[model samples]
Target chain A: MIGDSVPQGDNEAAAREVASGPVIHIRNLRKEYTSVAGVIPVLHGLNIEVMPSEFVAIMGASGSGKSTLMNILGCLDIATSGSYLLNGHDVAVLDRDTLAHLRNDLIGFVFQGFNLLPRASLLDNVALPLVYSKVSREEREARANEMLGKVGLAKYRDSQPNQISGGQQQRVAIARALVNRPQLLLADEPTGNLDSHTGNEIMNLFKELNERDGITIVLITHEVEVAAYAHRLVRLADGHIVYDGSSHEGAMSKNPTEYSAAVHSTS
Target chain B: MIGAMLNEAWVSMWANRLRTILTMLGMVIGVSAVIIMQAVGQGAQQEVQESIESMGSNLLMVLPGSSTSGGGVRMGAGALSTLTTNDAEAIEELPTVAGAAPSVSDVAQVIYGARNWSTQITGTTPSYFSVRNWDFAAGAPFTDTDLRSVTRVAILGKTVVDNLFGDENPVGKIIRIKNSPYVVLGVLSAKGQSLMGRDQDDAILIPITTVQRKLASNQVAGSVRFIMVQVKSAEAMPKAEQDIVDLLRQRHRIREGAENDFTVRNLTAMANTAAETTAVMSLMLGIIASISLLVGGIGIMNIMLVSVTERTREIGIRMAIGARSRDILLQFLLEAIIISIFGCLIGVILGIGGALAASGMTGIRVVITISSILLAFTVAAAVGVFFGWYPARQAARLRPIDALRFQ
Candidate 1:
C-alpha cells in the first residue's frame, strides 16, 4: 500500500523505502523530572512508529503522557531511557549542533499556543526557520510566501500576530511549520487553544497535506473528536499506550460530530 | 541568517515602543554628553595655546622680585636696580638676541573732551612692539626720532579706541594723560580677551623716554619696571636668557650665593606648563565622559535582559522552528550594537554643534577631528557587544520546553 502511494520509478522506490521505513521510530522511550521532593516520571517507556504520508493523532486525558511523548519526538526534550530514531539518525547520541541540524532538517512543529513571534509579520514568522538553514533571502521569502498562500494567509502576510484573530494566527503557525518542508510534522495540542471551527479548519489543512503532498503528521490532543481527523489514533493512559490502530474501528466509531458540536457550543 | 536575525531584533525592539525609546534616550544623552565635554575641553585648551603662541614663541620676560623672609616680614635691604637700558643694550648685542625693550606701566586717568577713562599707560622703547609681536590696525608705531626727542605720542589698543574715541578716529587725536596732552599715533589691533576674562586690548603704549622726561620725571631713566627680550630662534632662547641673567648679576655686583634681584621667565617653559595643566584637565574630562558611555552600556544590558525574559515563549517557538542558541544570541547582540551605534552617530552631530557654539561664545577655536568621531563610535560598538553578551547568552541558554512552560 505504501509503495502504491509512491511515484513510479527506481529513484521514487528508493525514496519511498527511505521515507516509509518510519520517519519517527521510538522504542521504550521514557522521560522523568527531578522535583524538590523526588524524581517524577512522565512517560513510562512509550513505543510508537509513524510511516511516510501518515496522519496520526495521540489522544489522552490531562497528564496522560501524550504531550511528553510529543516533546521527545519533536527533539525539544530528550528521553530518559531507550531511544528515538528520526530519519534513521540516533537522536540520543547526537551532539547539540547535530540535534539542531536534525530539528531543522527533519522536524516541523506546531504548538497549542500558536507561538508566532508577536512582533513579526506572518511572512517573517514563517521565514524564521530558513534563517538557521542558511538559505538565500530571496528563496526564503518566496518559500515563505508560498507557504502562507497554501495556508490561505497570503493577504495577511504583513500583519503582526497580535493584529490577526486567533484562527489566523494558528494558520500562520501552520504555514511556518510547513515552510521548512521537514520529514515529520509534530503538533502538540495544536487545537487546544482554538475554537472548534478553527480547529476543524486546521485539521482539514493537515488532512489535505497528508493526502495530496504525502507529508507525515503526528498530532497530540486530549479531545477524541479532534483525533478523528487523523487516519490513525493512539490512546494513552497512565503514561503508557493503551491502544494503537486505525481510527475508524475505535475512537472515530463514536459520533465525532456531536463531540465537535459540544466543544463548539461551549466555546 | 544574520540578516533575518537582525530583522527579528529590529522588529522586537519596535514592538515595545516605549521601552526601546527610553533605552535609546539614555544612550543618546550619554553619548552626547561625552562628545560635547571632550570637544569643549579640547577647544579651550587649543584657544589658550594659540593665545600664548600669539604673544611670540621665543620671547622672555624679566620681572623684579626678592625672596620673602619667614613670617612675611619686610627686609630693610637696599633695592637692587640692576635692570637698565644699558642691560637691554648689552642683551641686544648677543647674536641669539633678536631685539630687547624696556617697559614701565602705571594706572593713569586720561581725559579727552567730556569722557574720562582709567587705563594703564605702558611706557616702552621703540622696539617694544616688534619684540612683543603687536600689530597696528591703522597708522604707524613710535619712531626712534620720537623716542630720542621725547615726543608726547601714544598708541591706543582696541578697547581704548572704543572707550575714549567711540566713533571718531583716535589716530592723530589728542588725549590728556595725567593732565599732559599726547597725540595718538596709531591703534593696535584687537587681541580679544584672555582666559582670566581680562581685556587684552585696553592699554595705551607711549615712548619710555617721553614718560621719563615729560609725564613722570620722578621715574628714573634706565630704571624701567621690566625688560622683554626676543630671540631669533626658539632653540636659542635658553642661552639668551642665561647670558642676560649672568650679565645682569655681574653688573649688580651680586655674590655667588645671593639670589638675583630679577627673575627671567622663558616663554617656552611658561607655555609648556600651561599646556600640561590643560592636558590634565582634558584627561579628567575624558574619563568622566567615558563613564556615561559605560552607564549607557549598562542600560542596554538591563533592557535586553528584560526583553529576553518577556519573550520567553517566543524564544521557545524559535527554537522549535529550528533557531539555534547562537542565532538567538547573535540577534539580541546585533540589536544592542545597532542602538548604541545610532546613538553615537547622533552624538557626533550634537558634539559638533556644542563645539561651534562654545567657539562663538568664548572666541575659542575648536577642531572636531575625524579620529575622535571614529574612536567614539568604535567604543560605543564595543560597549554594546560587551554589555549585550550576558543577556543574549541567558536567552540562548533557555530550554525550549521550560521556556514554553513559562507563563
Candidate 2:
C-alpha cells in the first residue's frame, strides 16, 4: 500500500531530500555479460537505494543477478548503462585509483569464503586494511586488537587463520571488515559456509552491529532465515526487484512458517 | 609507506626461506667470481712490475749490432767489441746520462787457498758500482787509480765470497784469476737474481785495466764487451738513447744509412710489454667471469616470474584490501633489491676469502681493489632490478577479480 501510494520519482526525490543522501543510490542500473554467445543481460534496469544506518538483505535464487548487483554496489564491477552514486560520489565515472580509495575509506567487504590471508595472524589479518591507510604500526595493532576483542577473538590474536575453527575464522573476517570503521558493509552470503548454529550467531552479531553502531549493512543471501534478520527485505527475481518492504511483512505474506523463528526473534 | 612495504617484503622472504637462499646463491657465485678474477689478475701484474723494477729501471745496455740474428749463427748480442772505454767516457758526459761503465765478462776458474770455484769475472772501474747501484758488504771497491795502473784488486760478490772464502773475510785476501794473483778489495752486496734468471751474486768485479792488460791482454786493446749506461731519470731515457747513438755514429765514422753496429736496450720498454700482457689477460678473465653475473640475473628473473605466478592469490587479496598498482610493484621490486644486496655483501666476503685461498695455494699475491668490490655490488643490485622488472610488472598488472579466482 505504501509503495503504490507514492510514485517512483517522488520516492527518489524524498530519498535525495535527506541532509546526506542515501549511502547507495542507483537509477536504471543494468549489467550484461559478453561471452561467446554474445550479450546475456543479468540485471535489467534494477534500481535500489539504501539510506544511512539501515540493514537491508537482498534475497534471490541462482542466476537472479544478486551477485552481480552486489559486485556493482561494492565498486568491484561497473554497470553497463546506469548511474550508481555511493556516498555522493558517482562510482561509474570514478577511475580505478579513486574507486580503490573509496573502497578503502568507506566500504568493507566480508565474503562467504572467509577471505583471511592464511599466513597472517588473526591480528595481522584484521590490521591489513590499515596498512594501506598508512596508519602507524602501534595504532594499527591497538585498533586491530580492539576489533578482535569485539569479535571475542582477543585470545587468538596471534593464531593463524588455519589454526582457527570455521566459526572463529568468520569472526576474524568480521573483525577485519569493521577494523577500518567503514560506513558501508557489503556482505555476500557472510555465513554461507558455516553450520546452522554458527550462522545464527553471525546473523545476531550483524544485527547487533547494525543496531548499536549504526553501520549500514547490505547483505546478499538466498536463505529466508538470514533475510529475516534485516529490518528491510529486498528480493530479486529474473534480474528485477520483485519485493521491497519490512522483513516481518514480507516473511508473513510470502512464506511465514519457514522463517518463523527468525521473524519472531527479530520482531 | 616504504617501511610498511619493506616489512611486507621481509615477511614474504621469510615465508619462503629456501627459495630466497637458492636465488641468492646464483648472485653470490657470480659476484665472487668477478671479484676473485680481478684480484688475481691485478696481483700478477703488480708482481711482474716489481720484479722488473728490482732489476733496475734506469739501466740501458748498448750492445754491438742488433740483438736479432741475421745469419743464423745467433752469436748473441754484444759479442763484437764495437764499444770502447772512450765511448763509455763520451756517454758519461751527456747531461741525461748519469753514469757509464765499460766492462767485459768471462767464465774462468778462480782459486783462493784450498777452495776453488769457476765464476764469471767482470773487470770494470769503480764507476761500475755507482752505475749499477751496487753497495759494498765489506771493505771498499778498487779506486780509479787501480784501473789506470792495471792493479789486480778485486771485489767479491756474495756468492763468490761464500764459495771461495767459506764465510771468512774475503777482503784483503788474494785470489788467482788466469794464474794471476788479484787482491780482494771488497764484497759486493747480495743481488738475488737478474731479470734473465741469472745468478747475479755469483760473480766478481775488478778493474778494466786488469781485464785488458792482465786477463785478456791478447785481445784488442781497450776493447769492451758492452757499455752499461745509467740514465739520470726514466723520463730522459729516450733522449739519452738518441744522443748516445748520434755520438757513437760520429765516433765510429759510420756513413749515413749504414748499420751503426750498435743497439740500445730499453729496460722500461720490456717492463711495459710485460705489464700490457698481464693487463689484457686480466681484462679477458674479467669478461669471462662476468657471464656468470648475467646468468645470475636470469635466475632472478626466473624466480621472480615463478613468484608472481605462485603468489597470485596473495596479490589479489592485497589489491582488494586497498593496495594500489604501484604498491604491489614496489613490494616485489623492493624484495628483489633486498635479496641482491644481501647476496652482494655475502659474495664480497666469499670473494676475498677465495682470493686469499687462491693466493695461498698458488703462492701468488692477490690485490683486492675497492673499485672492483663497488662495481660488483652495483652490478648485483642492477641485476636484481633488470631481471625483477618484468615479473613485478606482471604481478602489478593482474586484475583483482581474476587473481582472486586463481587457484
Candidate 3:
C-alpha cells in the first residue's frame, strides 16, 4: 500500500481520519468506440478519486458514459487516453492477463443481470472467483460459505440460480463478488432488473457491507432511489461528470428532473 | 486451477448429457473403426506371414521347362522330363544351395483295415523334409539308409493321417499304397492352406526309388518333377538360382546357342507378392481409419463452435468475473480431450469385442495388440484437441464488453 503519499486536505482529514491512500485515482480518463460508421467518443477528460471504504454511486442516463466509467474502474476495459491507478498499480501499463489478475485481486464486479453461471450451484458460483485466484477447494468453499452467510443465503448454497428468487440470485452474485475479498466493488446497475422491494434489500446489503466491512463501493445507476443508497454520488451527462457531492442532494426528491437540474447547476 | 476448469466442464457437459453422448458417437466410431480394420488387416497379414513361413524360406523351384517347344509342337511346361535326381544333387553341391529335393508324385487309393482314401503320394529323400522345413507331429522321417535300400516308408501329412488312422496315431502303422505295404514313418504337422488354397497337408511322402518303381513307374530313367532347392540365406537366392540353372544347362549337354531346358522361379518372391498385396490392404485400412478420425475431428469442431456460440454470454460472464483467456481455452480443450478419451475407452472395448466376434465367426486369426489400441487413442485424442483448438480460440478471443453485451 502507498502509505501517506496522498496529499490530505484539512477538510478531508477532518471528514475521515485519512484512511491509507485513495483506493482509486483517475486523471483525464477518456474512452472511444470505433465502428465502420465512425469513431464515437464516450467519456471525455474525466478525473476522480475514491478513498478507501468510500460508498459512491455513478448515476447517468443511457449513453451518458457511467457504464463506460464503471467498466474502466472494474478493469474490464482500459481508457483510450489518460491514466488510472487502482491500489497504486498503473492500469495502463499492465497486459491483459495481468489486468485480469488485477481485477481478480483488487476489484469485484456486480452486473445488472447477475451473471452467475446457470449450471453451477450457488456455492460453486460464489466460489468461482477464488478458482481464478487458484484458491484450494476447501478454503474457497469456506470463504464462499462465509460470504454467503454474510449475504444471508448460506442455506440455499445448493440451489441453482433459476431455482432461487431474483433477490436471492442478486445476493448470490454479491457473495461471489465479495468472495475474493477485493478492496473495491464496482457495480453496474446492481439492482436494475429487480422489484423495488428486492432492490432496496440489495442496496441495504451493499450499505451494510460498506459500513461494517469498510469495503469501497462504486455503483452505476440512473435511478435516484438506488443512487441514494450510497453516501456520495457522481452524476455523468454526455461524457463528463456534472456533479460530485453528497447523495442526499442528488436524491433529495423522487422527481428525476429536480435532481438533474440541481446537479447541473450545483456542481 | 486446471481442476476447477475440469469441474466446470464436467458440470456443463453433465447438464447436456444427451448432446455429449451424441457428440461422442463420431469419436467412438472413429476409434473403433481403426481398431477393427487394423485387427482384420493385421490378422490377414499374420496369416500370410505364417503361410509364407510354412512354405519354407529362401526357396527356388526349378520346373521342367517353360512351355516345351519340341519338334515344332508347343506343349505345356513340364511335359518333357527336364529335371532329374542328378540335377538336384548338383544344385545341392553349389555353395549357396543349402538343400535340394527332387520329387515324383501320383494320386492313388490308400487303404488300411478296410478304410480307404484317395490321396497324393509323393516320393523324395529325407532332405525333402529339410528343404520344406517340415516338422513331424509324431515318429520320425526316414533316413539315408531307407533311401538307399529302397524301403517302402511313408510320412503322412496331417490330412492323410487323419483320413487313414482317425483318432489313432499313424506312426509305425502299415497301410497299403497301390496294393503294396508301406510303413508309416511319421506325420507332418498341419500347414493349413497355401496361398493357392491347396491343402498341402493332404499328401503322403515315401522314398523316391520306392515310389518311382512301384507306384508311379511311367517316368523315364533318372527323370523327376520340379526340384525344390533351398538356399543358405535369403540374400543368396538369386545367385543360387543362377548356379542351379548353369549347372543344369551344363549337365544336359545343351550348347551355348540353345534355350535352357529348365525354368527357375523364386518362391519367396511369389510369396512376397502376396505379402505386398496384404500390405496395400493394411495401408488402405490405415487411410480409411485416418479419414474417419478426420471426420470425427470435424464433428468435434462443429459441436464446439456451436457450444461456444450458444454460451458466448457464459464466456463473457467468466471473463468479467476474472477468468483469463487461457482459462477459457483450457476449459474447452479439456472438455474435448476428456470426451475423446472416454469415447476411446468405449471404442476400445467395443473394438475388442468386435474383433473377437469377427474371429469367432470367420475363423481368420485376429490379432489385437496394445500398440494398436494406443495408436487409436493417441491419434483420436490428437484429432479432438486439434479440432477443438479453433473453437476454443474463438471463445477466448471475444472481447469481454462485446461478449457481455451479446443478447
Candidate 4:
C-alpha cells in the first residue's frame, strides 16, 4: 500500500520532466498600433519562453510594452509579426474562434483591477468564463464553489465584489483564473493596487500556488519587490529585454552596488 | 439563452427603476389613448346606427327639398302640397308597403299652469307610431274615431311628460297648446338622444285632423307636408321606394326623367352615411395615435443609444470574454424590445380602462376588438426592433480594445 501511494519516485520524476516542458513559447513577437500621430510601435520584436510549473515575472515601466506582450500571450490580442506557440499550438495562425477556444481552454487572466462584474456575486463572477464556454449551470456552480473554497472564500461566495476588501477581491480573481485548471496563468500587475502588506501576502499566496499545485504563473509588474518573489525575472526597457535570468542573479547583475548596498544598509 | 437574456433585461431594467418607468410612460399613454379614442368613436357610431335602425329599417322619409338647392332658399317645383292623404293611401296600397302616414310638424309653446315648455307638435296618422317605432308607456294611442271626430287628444313624449306632469300621470289631463286645450291620452316611452344631439322624445303627437283644424289651418291645402312609409322588410326597401316614386310621379302627371317634388330617404341610406362619417373620424384618430407611437419608438432609440455609450466598458468586457458580435447585438436589442413590449402591455391595459371609463361616462357602447389590441402591441414591438437595431449594431461592431479603453 505504501509503494502504491509513493508511485515509484524515479518514473514519476522522469514523467514530470517530460510533461513540464515549455507551455508558452514566444519568438520575435511584435505589435504595433496606428494612431493619428502615425504608427506607434509598442512591442519591438520580443522573444521569451515560459515553462510549466515556472513562476516568471516581467518587469517594466509604464508604456514599456509589457502589457502588449501579456495581451498577446493571453490571446486577448494578436501579434502583428512573428509566431506565438502557446501550449504547443501556433496561436498566430489560429482563427478568431480557435483563438478564443485556446484562451478559454488553456489560459486564465487576472487583471490588476480584479475585473469582477460589479453587479454579479463572487461565485457568479468566477462562473462567467464557464458560461461563455456553454458549461452546464450545475457543473459551473460546483466548480466555482470548489475554486472559492480553495481560495478560503467559500462563505463569501454570495457576496458582491464591492463588499470584499482589495486582498479578498484579488483572491477571488485568482480563484476565477484557476477555475478552468488552465496550463498558464497570466496576472497583469496583480497586486499593484494593494498596500505593501497585502501585496506581500498575495505574493506569498502565488509562491504557495506555484510550489504546491505546480501551476505555471506569469505576472507583469513594475515593482522590484513584487518581481523578486518569482523564480525567474525578465526586465524590459524601451520594448526590449534588458535582462532575463534567476531573480537573485538578475538583481545582482543589474544593480550589484544597490543590491549589496541595500543588504549592508539594512543591516 | 433567450430566458437568460430576458432575465438579464428584467434585472437591468429594475436596477434603474426610474429610467425604466419614464421610458415606458410614452408607450403606455400612446397605447391607452389609441384604445380609448377608438372605443369612444366606435361607441358614438354604434349609438347613431342603433338610433337610425330603431326608427325602422324599411321606413322612408319624404323631406320636401333636395340637398343640392342653392343658398338654402325655398323653391317650390310645384306647390309642395302635392303630398296628400290620397298619396299616402296610394303608397299604402303598394304591394311592398307595410304602412304609410302623412305628417306635419310645428314648434309651439305649451302652458300647463305657470310652467310653459317649448316643444314640437307633430300631427300624424295612427300608422305614425308603428312606422317611427314609438311605444306608449301609459294610456293608449288614438283610435280611428279620434281621427274622424278631430278629437283634441294628444300623446306626450317622455320629456314633455316629465316637464308637464312631474311625478303625476299626464294621461287624461288637458294642456294648452298655443291657446287650444288638448287632453293627453298617452305618454311615449323614453328614447335616448341621437348622435347628432337631437332629442327623440321631446315632442307631442296629435291626430292630423286635429292639427289641420286647430293649429295650422291657414297653411293647409289639400295635402300634408310629408309622408312616412314603412316597407315590410329592409330587403324590400328599394322596391318600395321606387314604387312610391312611380305612384307619385303618375299621380302628379310628371314627364319621364322629370325630378319629383320630394326626396325619399330610407333608414339604411342614413345609417350608411353615418357609418362613412364615423369611419373617416376613426381613421383620422388612428393616424394621430400612430404618430404618437412612432414618437415613443424614437424616444426608445435615443435612450438606447445613451445606454450603449454608458455601458461601453461592460460591452468590451463581454466581448473580451468570448462573446460574439451577434451575441452583443442580440443582448442590447432584446433589452430595447423588452422595454418596448412592457410599455405596450401597460398601454394596452390603460387604453382598455380609459375606453371603458369613457363609455360609462358618456352612455355609449364601446367594442374593443382583439385585432386592435394585437395590432397596437405588434406595432409597439416592431418599433422597438426597428429603433433599437442601430444602437445595438453600433455597440456590437465596437472593437473590444477600443471599448475597454473608452473612459
Q: Which 10-residue window in model 2 chain B sums to the lowest lDDT? A: B66-75
Error of 3 at B341 (Å): 1.1
Q: What are the lDDT scores of the predictions, listed in order?
A: 0.80, 0.84, 0.86, 0.80
Among the numbered candidates, top TM-score falls to 3
Model 2 C-alpha lDDT per residue in residues A1-267, reported as the tens digit of each score: 111122222323433444276899988888999999999999888667889999999988889999989888887788999888886677777766666666666678888888898877899899998887778899999999999999999999999999988989999988988888877889999989999899999999999999999989999998889989999988777787777778877754553233323222322
RMSD of every prediction: 6.6, 7.6, 4.6, 7.9
Q: Quote the B-chain TM-score, candidate 4.
A: 0.85
Q: C-alpha displacement of B221 in model 3, angstroms? A: 4.4
* Tens digits of per-residue lDDT for model 3, B317-354: 88888888999899999988888888888888988888
- Winner by TM-score between candidate 4 and candidate 2: 2
For B1-407, candidate 2 gives per-residue lDDT tens digits of: 78777877888888999999988888999999999999998887777776675556588888876443676564566667778888998999999999899888788899999989999999787778887778788999888789788898989889999999986898898999988899998998887666565888999988987888778755678888888888999899989999999999999898999777788898768768877988899898799888998888888889888989999988877777677677788888888888888888998999999999999998778999999999999989999998888899899888776776678
Q: Is candidate 1 or candidate 2 better by TM-score?
A: 1
**Interface CA RMSD of each prediction in angstroms:** 1.1, 1.4, 1.0, 2.1
* B287-401 per-residue lDDT for model 4 (tens digits): 8888888888888888889989988887766666656567779989998898899999999999998888877887677878888888889989999999999999999888766
Q: lDDT tens string, model 3, A1-267? A: 332332322323422443477889988888999989999999987878899999999988899998888888888788999889887767788766766776776778898999989999999999998888788989999999999999999999998999999889999999999988778898889899899999999999999999999999999998988998899988788897777778998666433343434334423
Pairs that collide in candidate 2 are B65-B261
Give chain A TM for each model in order.
0.87, 0.87, 0.87, 0.86
Ranked candidates, highest DockQ first: 3, 1, 2, 4
Off by over 4 Å in 3: A1-19, A252-267, B67-73
Query: Candidate 1: which stretches are off by over 4 Å?
Result: A1-17, A134-141, A248-267, B1-6, B67-72, B75-82, B111-116, B166-174, B194-197, B232-238, B354-369
Model 2 residue runs over 4 Å out of place are: A1-19, A30-45, A61-65, A235-267, B66-81, B101-226, B233-237
- Relative to the real complex, the DockQ score for model 1 comes to 0.59
Q: Would you list the clashing residue pairs of candidate 4?
A: B32-B351
